[model samples]
Target chain A: MTSNASGRKNLTFISRRSPYGSGYAKACLDMVLSAAVFDQHVTLVFMDDGVLQLQPNQQAGDIHAKDLSAALAALPLYDVDNVYADRDSLTRRGMFSDQLAIEVRLCDADKIAEIIRQSDVVFTL
Target chain B: MTTLHTVNKHSLNSDLLTSCLRVARGGDCILLIEDGIYNVRTLEDLAARQGCELSGLQCCVLHDDLTARGLAEKDLPDFISAVDQAGFVALACAHRQSVHWF
Candidate 1:
């Protein structure tokens, strides 16, 4: 279903902020998921402290809400694959993909540039 | 061939400015929306020094946001254009895609 111009839109959602403290993260994730439901190709790139959202066993029990980590894990079932994490950001935070519950492709700085270039639409939160 | 980059946050920690600089192409335009209007001066200086071709790429600030923040056009770089919500929508439609940086 890939067309050069109009078949499907390529959307990249970049999350560089914390997931729990604010509504921005949740809103962004919701938007991306909705876009995916419409059959758009979606890519999620987590940078900086955004990687915290992917940490295994996130217990938001204290927050009195559905776990965000659980929602993020359901992305693949919705056909919203291509999750990525910036290598520098992960290393800077002393984390690795294995430490996360969701599988994420490690991307270097150059790859980050490529992601932006390839995306038809990008949202940063 | 037009591409619109929408910057919506004010903090340097947001890294939106860096992202804007990274993906900005020759003919693409940058729009400072929401809290992003504050970046016009810094971006203009960088654009000039980097010799980045911005004449073909319009730089705009949302007038509504500026007013709400108690900022004026004179406070921004002279090259930056100010637009309203209708103009913002027109800009997004004119561009092939829009990138939001927060």
Candidate 2:
């Protein structure tokens, strides 16, 4: 772990695209997984269209993409336990935490800003 | 300080690989991730030309991204090293900054 090499730097990946419309959501997940594999401290935030990524029963039936929810569920396994969704983003879409496919904390804009402030690197995928 | 130029597109489809190669300085290193791993052959060629043409340019690919795309590591030439996510973190830490060409 790089935690001891230097004070651990937090890398936060912000996902702003909906699932399956393009590669953005998957890219964010993959990048987060990579950071976690490197043993770097990392967090993932879903905002904007990204909130759709956590929606339950997502089916790419005809488009044929990997089941991203399964991967989201696997985040904790990779030590990426800080998955969060923007509260306003979710509310605007009429979504609640119970409606999500996986577990993620609902965060407001202020908290999102704080996380960004604390991050050494912020990747907005 | 060395700059880590990260390319995240396919060579056959995008110009990110060529652009990174053209502008990357002597101390800079190229890291292929996402679809960029498809350019391993191009990167290997650049690495092979280090002495006669290019100088001090290192190349590597993200192992997870490579395998996620169903690419085999054995096929990668000896010039490029496959690094895990932690290795990627070390690279980002060691370099002055990262330039991602999507």
**Candidate closest to the true structure, highest TM-score:** 1
Off by over 4 Å in 1: A1-7, A108-113, B44-57, B67-75, B84-87
Q: Predicted candidate 1: what Cα RMSD to the true structure?
A: 3.9
Residue B18 shift from truth in candidate 2, angstroms: 35
Q: Per-residue lDDT tens digits of candidate 2, residues B8-87?
A: 98877765665456446666678999989988877656434532234476788999999998887897878688999998
**Per-residue error (Å), model 2, residue A15:** 0.5
Worst 10 residues of 2 chain B by lDDT: B46-55
Per-candidate TM equals 0.72, 0.54
The positional error of residue A8 in candidate 1, measured at the CA in angstroms, is 3.6
- How well is each residue in A34-116 modelled by candidate 1, as lDDT tens digits? 99899898889888778778878877887786688889988999888788888777787788777886888898655765676
For the predicted complex of model 2, DockQ is 0.02
| All DockQ scores | 0.35, 0.02
Q: Give one digit per residue, the lDDT tens place, for model 2 in A44-108.
A: 98876789888888776646778888789899899888888988778878988778998998887
For model 2, chain A alone compared with the true chain A gives a TM-score of 0.92
Whole-structure CA lDDT of model 2: 0.77
Model 1, B33-81: lDDT tens digits are 8878767657866666656656767889999998788888788777788
